[model samples]
Target: MRLKGKVALVAGAGTGIGAATARRFVAEGASVVLTGRRPGPLAEVAADLGEAALAVPADMADTAQAREAVRAGVERFGSLDVVIANAGGHGGNAVADTDDEDWRLSIESNLTTCFVTCREALPALVESKGAIVVVSSIAGLTAGPAVAGYVTTKHALVGLTRSIARDYGPRGVRVNCLCPGWVRTPMADEQMDELVERDGITRDEAYALVTKDVPLRRPATAEEIAAICLFLASPESAIMTGSVIVADGGATAVDLPTLAFA
Candidate 1:
């Protein structure tokens, strides 16, 4: 068991990458606190994890809730040895099309939520000399056509990871960012459906086009992403900190302008 005595707090643990990571953390012997806005899904995931998991239904966008989520896990498991700030959704909009509320909500949900969770979890992690993994996306490392807000915030996470790493590494706490590309999740499914409806294409065709730039020809599974999060939190990556590990199936490695020749 990689995390035999560790206690982990996973935000956005109700579904997708967060859910998968929470399950994987448990399998690796960590007691996990699952926090998200959805109670039913949190309950279900916690049930599957049995006694090792506690479900805390709360909106991560709210700073108070994020802090409370961390506290709950520390209370139950004695110390917070790991924290995965993996809660986020796409803010689908063009630069000009994004209203103030859209931009604000996007920042709050993606960037601020991460900051809140990490800040609240720091003292516990500091005590344990634990690790923090912030989940960003490929969108954070590079630019997408119209997702200005997402791109901006994702990039912010990279800097955030580095900043926290520098400040806390001396104190024995490690920090890093997990940058994933398109993953086969509910959020990605919604994008696929939108493509199908808007372009009058079959689901498979839409999926193909969406993944065409990805050299792997498909998206990563939630389990795959979760596995990496496990590595980041475990002692296996002890020497790694302030790193932005991009797991994108070679999507970012491709040169889009020369794609047809390759």
Candidate 2:
């Protein structure tokens, strides 16, 4: 309800956090334009949200498509009050195993998409004095094992968030990064499958294996992350900008040696 009368552009809205955010925004009395690479899922989400939502399929990694998504959203919704750059994915085997394409795709999906979304939405966002909540990862704040390309791109999003916030804060646009740890989403599910296959373990075992380091002892739900995005997108987080908010179940708070003692 905090976002009553607002309009938001949510990239990667085909599913997971993006879909969840679109739902949350609608429930809070906002009009949402959902954009993603997949039209099927995006259409499904748009249908679910009824008249409050519109789906536009766009690959945010491309500048032209990113611009068009914003344009279409504005044309339908009249103005933009928030932009959620929630599109991203993992890449690379490890630093030693990663190839050029791995790095390129990772950067495109995770970092470039975010930059392009913010760039295209800034003019409208400035007019509306709106907010931009970028979805980075806990890896952005701290390194993770065997995900070199993902780690690099997420870390870069932190810088992008801060830079955007600093440059545009005085212009009435707010920018902040959400550093989420493990979450129960399609991306995380894919990673779980990879872990299971790589280690020859069951699905539950793979989940526990990855979540053992989390203080909460489980992965976050997409709704949980979306709730934070709602807060950041609303006036409740008015005092916060350029903040790297970590909602990782305390994964980054513990010292590795301390964990060993535990």
Candidate 1: C-alpha lDDT: 0.90
1-262, model 1: which lDDT tens digit per residue? 9999889999999999999999999999999999988899999999999999999998877878888888888888899998899887757689999999989988988898888889988999899999999999998889888788889998998998999999999999999899999888888888889998999998778778988878899888999999999999988999999999999999999887997787
Give a tens-digit lDDT track for model 2, residues 57-128. Answer: 999888898889888988988999999999988565788899888888888889999999999899999999
What's the TM-score of every candidate structure?
0.96, 0.96
Judged by lDDT, which candidate is best? 2
Each candidate: what lDDT? 0.90, 0.91
Would you list the clashing residue pairs of candidate 1?
Answer: none
lDDT of 2 at 80: 93
Model 2: which residue pairs collide?
A: none
User: Which regions in candidate 1 have their CA more than 4 angstroms from the true location?
Assistant: none
